[model samples]
Target: MEATRLEPRTLVNGDMVAIVSPASWPEESVPAWIARQVESWGLHAVIAPHTLDRRGYLAGSDADRAADLNQAIRDPEIRAVIASVGGCGSFRLVPDVDVDALRADPKMLVGYSDITALHQVWNAAGVPTLHGAIAGAHGDHVRRLLMEDADTVVEADRGALSAELTTSGSVEGRLFGGNLEMLARSVGVVDFDVAGGILLLEINRAAGLGMVDRALTQLRYSGALDGVVGVALGSIDQFAGYEDRGWTIVDTLRDHFDALGVPVLGGLPLGHIEDLVTVPLGTAAVLDVDHGRLTVDSPSGD
Candidate 1:
């Protein structure tokens, strides 16, 4: 299938950006601080009505979270949608989303971790979204991407980041991937397709080697690994008892993925980490593993 690249909507001064909690609601202090930071960017920040509501582990009921997300996608005035935080529950709201509406009016959709569900949804709908920092991210990180086009290789500090040309040259393809766990859950559901595309993935506290192994196994078993053009591994942050593990996480995965015959780079500063880099999912990008960089092409006619 030919890749469809979506043009990024420019954020004019005074434009509004909706901040919604599609996954988890951040603590009161953090969300408040984030809001102030957004306003400083010259773009108005409109926090969704239920962004602060909490129902156990979720930001709110599934319907409530889904409603805010849907409303943000359809809101013409809102040029971008930033997630509040990512814990869990975003997947529960995916089936309820109106993919057609989102596709009709695509904009910047940014978040990581649990927000992977939305990435998959947008990918299947042929819309490009961003897998990057949420509203709860550090103020500087959020401000950087919103201000202008950013170019930097992001990787976890502990994990190794390597730029090696595994393939003879670079290939441009649509970006598709997110949190390993959330992506694993979408394996055979007909929504996740990794074929002939660049896969950008990262994990968080649940970085047990076994957990990573299981998730990768699921991707391999479900035929999602077939024809994957390249693999970009983002930060796999502090794992519970990760230090106790005898082998480094990157080394373990490297042994497994080496045979895939595609470029695999690590140390992407993404996932549940500070200074996260935003990647536009479903967009065409040139993955130059040889030169150690990924360049997102300006959407056609932009």
Candidate 2:
């Protein structure tokens, strides 16, 4: 396995977290709601200067958004950095990020969807991130990881996870994946280490069945899934939209993933779900398909 990441020191009740927007703009009330939510965890929330700034669809200009994120990453008082929401502009901000400072002062970064680009950047810098929202049921999981410990274990099954097994077996490897589309977009551009890892995927939009199939097919063609040990599928919000004249998303999933000959388990309450669960990206994990479990092996240290 590749060298595991060195997670930052866990936050405490008195620590502070910075909320910024590197992607599209969130609702006017979102940042405030997130601030309140973080405060409830006993941690103060520092809303970045440009967090709510608007420039068309993005929270702000690419430079400004990147600045907000870079500032949060460089701030010593910030115990954690979370995105306010996900949109299209994050990928554009990646180039301007202060990668050097981020590496020197690594802190937890959490978000999903377009934030997947940011997560990939952090993971590459040896900082694992939580894949979930900053608010709601899944946010609780993110809070626990930040305030408590990284040496933790997470499980899924019929009770906590309403998943179905397309192929059944067991396997263990580092966890890698987020928004399927974002991940696929990074196939050539980002050095995503999917090799020998359990790929976790979820859908945020009901784009189309063809697009979904094409994305997965692209991943396969790019050899991004090469040596991948298993696949843990997460929530597909509005999944019914893909059903057309008997052709469902499930059929599409089985078509693409089953051929990989790896354990494929779907129905995880993760990403774009009614209840999102925080999933650590670029961490060693295990997937037991037969038992319907995906356990994150939160290590003690690097």
Candidate 3:
């Protein structure tokens, strides 16, 4: 039997949202900006105790980061938990997260990039999570996704690097996957439901196209990509002009995706890019490559 899908209640005026640093610490002013943004939506924002703490690349020690996240999860007043920024180290806090507590009291967990780690955990726990940048210019867009009741439509951006690469037709399924590196790393180590979903693929600056090739290959061989019905490609930043042995990033991505042979819609502006859109993962999405559009529905309880 399939586990019933769970959707956290949408945000309302005056609801308190926890600003946390479950990954690497954000810029000194990011949390404050995020707080002001939340207030602009008529919502309250609480900066978690460890949001500003920095211990190396991480926001703080794993225990401290996890404590802040767990507190937000268990708190009745916190209607959402939003990561201030995404750098690295979220995977380290996974073991210490109170996923069960979140399952008992579902609320939104929003962020992208490194926060992909926590998104997978939350989505696996049966609640939906949002993938987007927190402090970027798109905060208003993120606000609407969390606060409004409407579907999200992401049209392929012709200007984006991934725009030229896509498969044929359209397919609908739950939207799964995020930062390619994170998803690849999660395989075997972390368990989640990707079966029968549309995989969302995106990447940031990496050493080379080999990193992209390896991540996709790992997903293919590890059976992690099994049962995925379609693919939605997002920003592949800093890889357009890059070439590894004359193979462009697009060439590398097409090589792997061609084998999956699923409907793939590329250039959705929802990844590690500025002017990003907030998208709900662990929910239904229609990926239409022929029409160059992807429509996403928020997760709803069965």
Lowest summed lDDT over 10 consecutive residues: which window, candidate 1? 158-167
Against the reference, the lDDT scores of all candidates come to 0.71, 0.78, 0.84
> Model 1 over residues 217-267: C-alpha lDDT tens digits?
888777777888888767654653354347656555666577577876555
Model 2 segments more than 4 A misplaced = 150-162, 299-302
* Model 3 score (lDDT): 0.84
lDDT of 2 by residue, 7-102 (tens): 677777798999999999889999999999989989999999998898999898888898888888888998788899987887887667787887
Alpha carbon lDDT of residue 191, candidate 2? 77
Please give the ranking of all candidate structures by lDDT, highest first, separated by commas. Answer: 3, 2, 1
Best by lDDT: 3
Candidate 3 per-residue C-alpha lDDT over 1-302 given as tens digits, one digit per residue, 9 for 90 to 100: 13336678878899899999998888999899989989999999999999999899989888889899999999999988899988899988878888778888888888888889888798778788888865566667677778886578888887778887876897878887889999999887678677778899878876788888899999999988888999999988677687777889889988998988888888888786768888888878888889899998964332
Query: Lowest summed-lDDT stretch of 10 residues in model 2?
Result: 157-166
Q: After superposition, how far is residue 2 of candidate 1 from its true place, in Å?
A: 3.0
For model 2, what is the alpha-carbon lDDT of residue 162?
26
Q: After superposition, how far is residue 224 of candidate 1 from its true place, in Å?
A: 1.4
